[model samples]
Target: MLHYFFKIYLKLTGWKATGPVPKDLKKFIMVVGPHTSSSDVFMGFAFRSVLKLKHIKFIAKQELFKPPFGFLFRQAGGVPVDRFNKNNFVDQVAEMFIQNESFAIALSPEGTRKKVDRLRTGFYHIAKKANVPIVMLAFDFEHKEFRFAPLFFTTDDEAADYNKILTFFTSVKGKNPELGLEHLLN
Candidate 1:
């Protein structure tokens, strides 16, 4: 219903979705990266709609679940997470995945629109513990295209995996100049 409408809207607009459909229906994690602006939300929403992906969920800050907007967030498959908590969010998410068996949780490794010293490693940890592959989603505003890279398997070498993930974002062009890697990672 609403998802179908959004998919049509995105097609009418300039946004394009390119990616591989999931082969396995089991649990998995999606890593959306180089998040640089509010537009990332719109783009991600549009992509999700286009894919017609049921059971897809994203983790958002708890504050975004306030009244009026809370319903909308839930409607769009958002799960509220308290970012300030010292608890093991990764393990918690992994447990959820294991319990659900069909869960596909989405996260922005960048953690915020602003630049950061390094990408948060929670996505990797969750995927590894859950024994699920990662689906890499990226937005190239300059090209007016959104790409879905092949599912990535977490390796023993975390740094190597991180570098591989970073390589995909290297060619993506964003409207904001500050979205470059300098501000993205330490």
Candidate 2:
């Protein structure tokens, strides 16, 4: 099906996924880091296809669900969320995990492709609130590889956990290294 197509696409694009696949986990929050390019979405789709993890969904702004590219996003397991709303997104996304028998979502910790002072904590809070583990996914453009870390269960100590997460992703080089999280290591 589309999975095979995406797999072929990855090969054609000179990209490959390399890491341990978490096939046993029924639900978890996957944090993809160094999201320095819009092309990450297409690579993510190919990565998901290569890993055979089509069930892992992702959230985007409501506008991306509109015409033109909307259909493609929906087909790629995208769930639109209202970014302007006052509603608590963490709670809303946590509820999604509670309601589903098996649900996994991918989020970008950097939140934007631009350099940032620090990573967002929404993924951590959602994983903690939903009682699910957080998995780290790395986009290493230097190696042309999509890497995955094992299930990382959030602990009570937020700072320590963030340190560990940050350490894991700091070595990864993104499509746009200048805009990636490597600077946060300082």
- Candidate with maximal lDDT: 2
**RMSD list, candidates in order:** 2.6, 2.1
Report the lDDT of model 1 for residue 31.
80
Once fitted onto the true fold, the runs of candidate 2 whose alpha carbons sit more than 4 angstroms away are 63-72, 84-86
Looking at candidate 2, what is the lDDT of residue 95? 86
Q: Flag clash pairs in model 2.
A: none
What is the Å distance of residue 170 in model 1 from its true position?
1.3
Error (Å) of candidate 1 at residue 117 is: 1.9
User: Local error of candidate 2 at 161, Å?
Assistant: 0.7
Q: Return the TM-score for candidate 2, rounded to 2 decimals.
A: 0.89
Candidate 1 lDDT over residue span 1-186, tens digit each: 767787778778777767786646567788876688888887777677777665779887788999977988887798887767776788678778888847898788878887767888999999998888998877777777778898878999988898888887766865574764544332
TM-score per prediction, in order, is 0.85, 0.89
What TM-score would you give candidate 1 relative to the actual structure? 0.85
